[model samples]
Structures are given as C-alpha cells and as structure tokens.
Target: MKKNTIVTTDTIAAISTAQGEGAIGIVRLSGNKAYQIFREIFSPSKPIKKYQSHRLYQGSVMNGANTSSLDQVMIAFMKAGKTYTGEEMVEIYTHGGSNVINSVLQRVLKAGARLADRGEFTRRAFLNGKMDLLQAEAVLDLIRADTDAARVQAIKQISGVLSEFISSIKKKLVQVKTNIEVLIDFPEEEASPKQLFDLKFILQAAHDEVMHVLKSYDQAKIIREGVHVVLIGRPNAGKSSLFNAIVGENRAIVTPHPGTTRDYIEEAINYKGVKLVFTDTAGIRSSEEPIEKLGMEMTRSRVEKSDIVIIVTDPSAASRYDEELSIAKEHKDNVIIAINKVDIASKDQIEQAKNAFEDYSVFPVSAKTREGVESLVQGISGPSLAPSIENAPVINRYRHKQALEHIELSLNAAINLIDQQAFPEIVAEEVDSALAGLKELTGEVTSQDILDKIFAEFCIGK
Candidate 1:
C-alpha cells in the first residue's frame, strides 16, 4: 500500500455520484492525467484549442471517433493548485444511470486513469494539505448523518470551528512549554512564585477545557449514531401498536393473539430533529412454547443494548406487567413508563399504573389514538439532543476523544511537576508530549494505518 498520495502522479477516476437512475451522474478524475483523459474522450460542440480551468463545457463523450458517441455530458476542468486534490481534476456530468456512469468511468480508466480507492478523492485532498484530519473526518460524518442536528455538527467541524478551538488550546500549551524551556535554560534564575502560579493556571484551564469536550462525546455519539430505543412489555401489551404509531407506518403486525410477533422489529423516526431508532421487541412473557421462549431471550438482549426502554403497558391490567416493569427497573435510568391503551382503561387503572411505577416518568398514551406519543418522543430524545449548532465542538469521534485524553494526562502531569517545583526540563517534556498529541489530532503526524482506517469508512465514489 502507498504510504502517502502526495508524491504520486497517478490519475484516478470513479463514479462520483450515487448509483442508479437520476437526472445526472458524475464521473470524477484527479491528478496529472485528468485533463489529458478528459480531452481525449470528450468532443466539445464548439472546437476549442485549450480548456480553461473551472469552466463547464457542453460536450459529447465519444468512444473512439466522432461517429461512435457514448453519452451527452458537461465536462468541468479544474486546474491544478486550485482543485480538490491539489492536482488537475475533471468531472463529467452524464445522464444518471448505472450503465451510463459505469461506461464513462471505464473509458476514463482505459484512457490511463486508475480507479480511485475508497475515499481516495478525499484522502488525496487531506494528503495534499487541502484539509486537516478532523475536517476530513467531517466530510464523512456529513455524508453519514441521518438527522439535521448531526449534519449541523458535521458542517461545523468541516468549517473549522472545532479545529480552531483545538488550535487555540494547542497554542496556549506551546506558550506554556516555551516558558518552561526559558526557566530550564537559566537554572541560576529560580522560577518565582508568580511565574509558577501563572503556569498552573494555564494548565488548569486547558485541562478543564479538555474535560468539557470529553464530556460531550456521549451526547455527540447519540446524535451522530441515532439513539436505540426498545419498546418492551408483556404479551399483547400493544408494543407493536405503539411501534407503528411512533414510526407512522404499519411496520409490525398487530393481532389479538399474544405471540403473533415472535421476533424484534425496528424502525427509525425523527422526533424534533433527533433520530430515534425504535425497536419493537417480542413480548416478554414466561411461555412454555419454544418460539415464544426464544423471542423472550431476544427481548432481554435488546434491553441491554438500548439507550432508552419504553415500557409499554395496558392500563386496563397494568398490575399484570410486573415482570416487564422489573426489566425496566434494572435499567431504570433510561426507562420511560408509557401506560398504553388508555382509552379503554378506567380511571382506577391509570391510578394503579401511576402508583406502581411512580419513581419513573410515566406517560399515559393511546397508540391507536396517537395521544401523548409526541410528548413521550420528545422526552426520550430531548436531554442529549444538542440545543443548537452553535455548540460546534461536539467531539463526535472516539479518535478525537482518545487524542484529548492523552493531552489531558500530559497536562495533568505537567501541573503536578509544576506544583512540586520539579526541574523545568521535566515539565517541558510533558508539555511537549501534549503538543505532539495536538499535532496527531490535526494530522500533522499520522500513520498510514490511521489514514486508511479513517478514509476506508467512505464509499468508493467519495
């Protein structure tokens, strides 16, 4: 595998748009041969001597001679030093169809353009100094985001909001290191109390800021990867009904029989811009039947993985749901007591449900009528949902958290050394370690393995 793509002069091509039929599809190529390949295959309507940079030209993709026409396309030529890969680039917008785009890509490849690897386009951009590691990851995040909130976070990261924050902290750390070095150079000039106090303050501030960002990882992950919500209750407790109501579709079967739904079903719903992946599990019950017993086991497994468990209940006989309630109790922190089928129940039954799970936040909902379901959804997705995009540095990646952890530890060590009045040399070393971590965060120093792992998450077209 190539260590870096910066020095390579190979021209790479790929079908840069989604597969299947649409109004338009893009075949993209980058590197030295991009323009050469484009000119060779593309026959413009008007004869032109030289293709200008950043201009779109109407043309036909010719197979070999003028008589053999492939497809009508608009070819864009972007000059080197002003393109995405820091190399010459070409984009062919053809009629959107799998065969059409594939044919164009093959022609570009046959014209000496190599097939781009997964995320090779973005990878080249990163390697060529177009964007840093965090910004490059944002490109993938923006593509994968399922909700508006997640998209906003990704956009902020791409726009360098998070990078700027990290750079600020890094700058301060560098200044602290320089101060320590100055003290180390003159051992005769003992560091004053004021100078030591100043160093301590700076280190503490950086440590606190790191913690602030670290603490947001859970919330960010919930947004980036939608929250897993499981609807669990006893057999015939209306779990499927509630699931259908929330998903706004007839996804799971609804029946009078208790064990009709023997397996789990999942669907995603956007509640106030937050994506909630609600899974309707097999009704939890003590059944002697083999299939039903197997289903109960799956319910338990889903409960363990869920971020929120909505304990669906029949208000008419809420007391009969003790076993399901107990499961909710085990994960009580994330449990939502939803007393379902409220329309048929008496006032006494609703009161009984309230008393039974009074410790949990109980909501009376009628899935068939779609009452109180909206509020329930808001409650489940609200707390962790980011209030706005202005909170830009929401640390979505575990890699970013890991890098911050290393920097935190180094800052902590530096603080301890300063407190003990240890030699400034030792403190400077710890500070340098922290600086190295910052460099790693932004791709100033990255291994081929790391780059491959990050970019491999992208699809080939990216």
Candidate 2:
C-alpha cells in the first residue's frame, strides 16, 4: 500500500468523476490557489474580471501551454468556508472522454496544483470540521452502498444522527465524572442518598444505551453487507431447482440425474431492501469419486460460513432423510428446512418431513411450480435471522462497535464501584475512561494512522 501525503495547505487537483466515457467529467481543485489555477486555464464565454462563488460559468479549457483550447466546459468556483472542503474549490466540467478528462486534469496539475491522493478531498472536509469522522466514513459507505437499506443507513450517519447520539452519551458521562471529581476534591462532604441514586441512574442509563447500540450491530452488518445464504442437501433433492426458483431465474442447471451440479452457483437478489446472496452448492453425500467428494467438501465448508443454510429435501429421498437431517443439525441455529417437490408428494409425506425438522423453521415448496417460494424467501431474513433495521441508528463499522464495547466495560466497572461506595477517585477514573472511548468513536481523539486506513478504502478523487 502506498502512503498518502496529505497537505491541506497545498493546492490539490484530481479528476473527481469516475474515469470513463460519460456525458460529463469533473476535474476538482481545492486549496488557496484553486481560484488562481482556474483563472489560468479557463476562458469564459464572456470576459469577466471576477468569478462569482457557487455560480457555473460556460468556458473553454486551455492546454498546458495556454496556446490552444483543449475542451469546451463549464466551471464552478466555490469560496472558502462554504465548500465541501471548507477551502476555495473549483470544478471544471468537460466531456467525459478519457482523453478530455485526463487533459483537463493534467492542465490543472501543470498550473501549480499537486495531484490529489485517494480520499484526500474528503479527508480535507473532515479536517476542516465540515463533517465528523462518522460522516466522513458514511460518505464512503454511501458511495459503495449496493442496497436501499445500506444507502439509507449511510445517509443517516452522514446527517450526524449517530454522531449526535454518541455526543449526547458523552455529555451524560461527563456530567457524572464532573460530579465525582467535585466530591473527590471535597473529601469532608458526604454524597447524599439521592445524589448516589441519581449518579447510578445516569450511569445505568448510559450503559443501557450503549448495549442497545451494540445489539444493533448484527442487523447493521446485514444491512451494510448482505447475508450469504447457502443451499445444501443430498443429490436429486431439488437444491438446484429451488435455487433457480428463489432467484427468479434459471441461474443453476437442474437435471433429474443425481450430482448434476458439480460446483456451486451463486446469484444475488434484493429482498426487502436487503441483499441475499444464494449459493447452490454440490450435494452433500458419501461418494468415492474424487471430484464428487471434493464438491461435497466444498458444500460443508460453505454451510459453516453461511449466514443461513437451507437444507433441500424431497419425499423420494426417504432413505437419506436422517443423513440430511444430521447435516442440518450441525448448523441448526441458522438452518431452514425446505421440503421440495411438495406438488407431487402426498400430504402425509409433507407432514412427516415437517415433523422431522420440528426443531428448525421449515417451508414446504415445489420449485417447479413456484409454491411457497416467497414464504421461504421471507423466512431467510426473518426476525430470528436478522433484526429489524427500520430507521434506527446503528453502528455498522467495526471501529464504532469496538469503541462501544470498551465504553460498556468501563461503564460496568464504574457502576459496580459506585454501588460498593468505593472512593470517588476510582469511580471518576472509570467514568473518564468511558468518556475517552466516546472521543475515540467520534474522532475527537483519533490517531493519524487510523484516519489514513479509514480514508484509504476510498477511490482516487473521492
């Protein structure tokens, strides 16, 4: 990995838009010299001595030597303190052909502007206090979000919902710490019963809020990164057919012959704003053939890593019912039984199959006729598997979750000490530690290395 050299004072320029052919491409520059650089390269349709801030002007970009025009364009100049980076910024819009975009960027670079590093633009925005670290991370999340839920969550974070909530928690901790510190200074004064009760109440409330946010991490994980649902069962159990039915396309090869699927086939579908990646793996069964055995091994491996494992079976495979049920039991916590071929099976067979997996959630469906497939889809992301992620603020990043866990531990220690009527100094120390965790979470006391790693995940020019 290359190191990022971030010098906010220096004039930086880059192609902000993705590199490709499109209707328009943007070359962005930010710093003290942004306006000066723009003046050197841009020739407006009408001559003007001064450019108005936040106004787009039709123009033509000049070549590096300023002897010929490179491309017809539109330019916008934003004044410092009101721009995304809180610095004077300029954007040149040109035709999105590779040549035109590159030429425009090179011209800006030649005009005393250093090339912008990956995520340097947003990094500047963070350093300038236009947005907090959580919002900065959300910007990246928004760009990479593939589902509606992820996008909405990212938008909420970017709007400072999570930051404000954490800030409020920190404020409460600070108040408790201040009270303890005052008591420590005046050792002659005794804490009244009501005072002790109030302090404990605040601490307990803060702890509960932290735990609530922590519980949401699992659901946030599902929202930000979709769950992997793997299909597993013996050959001729209709695993491939079920896979095709759920994905609403013939993504996998379905045949009457056993072991038709030699490898896994995967397809993704967005259901209820959550992405579900379904993998139809080779049948799990005892086999002497080397290739079939390898495929079976892969199936078991997928089952272990999957977020949800669907065990496909049919009444015709009665002899292997126990064998398949045994495999499902290994991951019974996340396993869902899908009794396929129910369209032709007798009612007793379906009832018997359902009774066999009474311990797990079972859905009887015929892939050929598409019966009960929707119910099976709904079951994949049911409340037992994924928590409700409607509008509630959640900590999606591991960084935030780890900080919250540390804060919880500190709060727990403080609460215990307070209950025991320990020395004010010791209790204050624990509360202070929890406060530090909050600072770290909101980037009030973040390390340079951590900031680099966070922003490095962004693409160039973001």
lDDT of 2 by residue, 1-462 (tens): 111234368999999899789999999999999999988998888888777999999979988555789999999999998888888999989999999999999999999999988898999988887787888999999998888778888898898888888988988998998888888888899988788889999999999999998998877877877888999887889999999999999889988898899889889888877788899999787889999989988887887778899989897556347886787778878889999999998888888898888898999999999999999999886663433546556898889899999999999999999899999899998999999999888777789999999999998888
Candidate 1 C-alpha lDDT tens digits along 331-434: 97999989999888898899989888889999899998999988888888888665466654768788988999999999999999999999999999999999
TM-score winner: 1
Task: Tell me each candidate's TM-score.
Answer: 0.91, 0.87
Model 1, position 382: C-alpha lDDT score: 81
**Predicted structure 2, TM vs. truth:** 0.87
Error of 2 at 242 (Å): 2.4
